[model samples]
Target chain A: MRVSELVQRSGASLATIKYYLREGLLMPGEATSATQASYGEEHLRRLALIRALTDVVGLSVQKAAEVIQLIEGPGDDLFLTLGAAIGALPPYVESSNEQAQDYPLARTALERLGQVYDPDYPAVGQLDRALTAASAAGFPVDDDRLELYGAHVRAIAEYDIDHVPEGPAQGAIEYAVLGTALYEPVIAALRRLSHQDLAMRRFVPDSATDPAGS
Target chain B: MRVSELVQRSGASLATIKYYLREGLLMPGEATSATQASYGEEHLRRLALIRALTDVVGLSVQKAAEVIQLIEGPGDDLFLTLGAAIGALPPYVESSNEQAQDYPLARTALERLGQVYDPDYPAVGQLDRALTAASAAGFPVDDDRLELYGAHVRAIAEYDIDHVPEGPAQGAIEYAVLGTALYEPVIAALRRLSHQDLAMRRFVPDSATDPAGS
Candidate 1:
């Protein structure tokens, strides 16, 4: 398709599309002539992914590029590699039974989480970081909240894994990455919806009973 | 504190701080001299909130300014108003549901959410629009995924409401908006973590998992 058609189909303007192309965010079309180029489905999908990363989820072009590169790169273990990278961050302190001797209550709960759902170590480790960050930031997350989040994560993971069509390992990875990319917006909307749910429970007398009121 | 001090404390740079003041994202400080201005806790908090929206979440300066305006605007009912606004433009839809529905899922969720939540209509509306545009552009998403996101949102909301000292309305709004705004990084991290959890369960030998796994 022409650039104009691409713009219309993508719901992006000519200028914005040009900006993306200039930034190397959108790959160039095949140069059919001095002034003309052709695009295909790959370009469409790539552009769509770029839009989601930058425009929807609000990643910087730089950060989005890094993530996109990771997804598009030649590694079969990108998820594992990315997990390792995240786990190495200084702030990501896990609450292993051995590691959590400093915080017995937190340690006990971590063990219990292991028993309930049996998440792998990486999941637990990152949740530890998330919990730590939230707590340090003065949010009132505790063992209960962390455990709840773990359960929720497990549920979503199960659903996502179950739904994909059977395919080769690379196909599975791409399907998961590209398909799951949609969650950035989906979850953002859900967060807004949940906020609305909470606010109604708090402020509107006519709304449902407040879940947090207790 | 001087503007530089405010910048350090708020984790915003001097230039970004100036941009915020110029853009009305932050209220100006009392000018001590032509080249000097003093800031206080209010400025610190506002600057942090602005950073959360603009830098962390990647909202454009213009859009971030609008969100700041709505947040700072007068009313005991701003939370309700914000919820209403967020609901109006909701961010997700079940592809299957789009055809049968009048509004998109995000919008419908917001409207329905309004009936159950408070009435922060405008912010809710903006959030919905942003999410919808993002989803349409193909950031990974599905309805089941969004429902998990709803749970995460509620968890954060509960934590913020329960933890922040006194929990003034501005603080609540800030907590909510910043939570929503900064969600991209948070969710990205979580997505990586979740993927790691799944991969470990499937691929790793059973005796021991990587401590960095979870």
Candidate 2:
């Protein structure tokens, strides 16, 4: 397949395909001539993954490159590969240099979380960054709230892992990465829907009976 | 206080404060002269909220303005205000126009969710968009997965609404908005940490018993 065919099949612009090639996110096709290169099924697959990461998962090019590297690198250890993929995600909450004072509160929250999970896990830093940002914004999350949120999330994680298909290492790793990346928004959107449901229950419980009047 | 003092008090850059002012996100100060004006405590508060929305909640400047308008507009209807705040959030999952074919599957999942919640809710649209994007990326979420994710999220939302403080309408609305915004990343981070824990348990159960080596 040519680059144009890659574009047609992947629904990515020609320039985007070229950009991924330049950035080493997409491997170059086999050279057929000075001006032409032939792509293969592997190229199409890689391009799809790249689009999924960048477009759907919303990773930066640099972070997407890290994911690509993990996919292409040596060991087939599922644990290590999954770890690297999770680590490559850019933090959803960023800590600010000006708000160093908020770190102590965030650290306290992280310490409580560490008691239940790995203290040095990459998610710890990500959680700390989120707590720090929230605290700096004057919306500090206390220990109880953190624990409550953690408990529910742990349940979700159990379901997530329980469903991973028994298969090859690469398949498991791909499932972990793509599942985590893509399903995040699903969870978030569900949360929002739940919020509306709860809000209605709280604010307009009688409206259920009234039907048309209020 | 002057613009400089507003900057000092809000911890926002003078340029940023001015930009917010120019963009109508922040109201203009009272004019004392042709070139000079004085801001008040209201300005300071609004600036803080704007910063929290943009910096912590990651809302765009446009979305933040919608939040500001909701806060400043007439009526203390907590339900309406909270709804507006949630509605103003830009969709976390965006589907491309080219991927219209994927929407039907997403809409089907959303229809099942609608059986339990409001089908017309903005969050339904958000969830649909996310599902569509994932399906287009070849990561279609099954009905079982959607149900599993929704159940956990419903539990989280129960905790969220239960914890809303007893206060005036405006205060409760503020708490709801800020809590929802700030805790999103916390929930996401916890999910990731749980994933790591579950992965280790599933993939390396022997590591726990062996301690030293396998």
Candidate 3:
């Protein structure tokens, strides 16, 4: 369909679609005329993902662009790869690159995570790609923190797979939808709520506390 | 302890402490003499919580103040309270003027959550408080979505209780820490990794038919 039709179907404005195309976030469809191009399902899906990340999760356009590229790239072991990307784990760093070697603490953390998870060979490569994407986007996680995050990821993913209904395959798809559709708002809301609750609990007099319990 | 001592123990700079005081986020310690007010352990803890919310999570002083108020107030079924606070479910609307007929939507959602969980009264209250805390901090969740989140939270909490090393009490604490401390970064990493991995598997030319299966 034409850009106007794509906008109506996708629920995105024509200007926004143009902006996305310019930013290389949306690949244009086959050209029907000098002024018109046809879009299809792929564009719709991409638009939805973009909305989730940018509008819902609040990632910068540049960062979102990098994420889109990674998603559309070539790799195996997507689950593990996704884990790495979300955590900003580096894929491969050469030994002699001084800047890359700058944070020993972070690098060590990543290494330790690799040791603990035992996610097979493919898992390691995927983790590295995520790391690369994070670095390229300039998210401020150090290697050590990345690895710590990796361990946490392993735990949550394990918990999610083991616990969610209909086995890992179905759970995986639910997870993807949840992450894309619901994760951002849920997290943002929870964080705001917890912060307030903790702060209030700390300063207020312990009225409910029983002396006997203490 | 004087402000100087409080500063040393809390690791907060004098300027920051002053800011908190001005913002009404931190209450003044007991006054022992002119220019020599004394703070105690309670002050120290409150300061730490404030720093976590403001410095780490990046909430504004005004927003932080409102959250702190709710946390300091009466202890009730937190889940229910949170639901009320965030409008995820009907919050019982504590004030006298709030009319029994108002907020029908919120009331319904809260009732649904109460039925599904059958949590003891306190747990319901905590969940409500959590939701409220999140809402006041500007998480952008409406009452209806919060009910959906309540189900997710219930699922995760139940699953963790069943599987984790400790009993429900300890498990609850652990999940709280994990959710509060690690969920944000971890989820971000996972989303990135998942998207790239899936994209590569589905779209990358000449790659294996299923990268994950491979």
Best by the TM-score measure: 2
**lDDT of each residue in A1-214, candidate 3, tens digit only:** 7888888988789899999999899998899989878898879877876765554344457756766665555255545544433432212234454554344333344344433222232233334433433333223345444444454444434433333345545334434433443344443333334333332334333522321111
Kindly indicate the candidate among 2 and 3 with the higher TM-score.
2
Which portions of model 2 show Cα errors greater than 4 Å? A30-48, A74-88, A92-103, A113-121, A165-168, A201-214, B1-11, B27-48, B74-84, B87-103, B113-120, B165-168, B200-214
TM-score of each: 0.63, 0.77, 0.46
Candidate 2 global TM-score: 0.77
Which candidate tops DockQ? Answer: 2
Per-residue error at A45 for model 2, in Å?
4.9
lDDT of the structure predicted as candidate 2: 0.71
What are the candidates' individual DockQ scores?
0.19, 0.43, 0.05
Clashing pairs in 2: none
Which structure is stronger by DockQ: 2 or 3?
2
Quote the RMSD, in angstroms, for model 2.
Answer: 5.2
lDDT per residue (tens digit) for residues B93-130 in model 3: 23344342243333344455443322222223334433
Ranking by TM-score: 2, 1, 3
lDDT of each residue in B1-214, candidate 2, tens digit only: 9888888877889889889989899899999999999999888767766766775455779988887777666266766676667777745434345454244554576456553445445566667767766766567788888887877788888888898778666666766777776778778777887787666656677534432211
Q: B-chain TM-score, every candidate?
A: 0.61, 0.71, 0.45
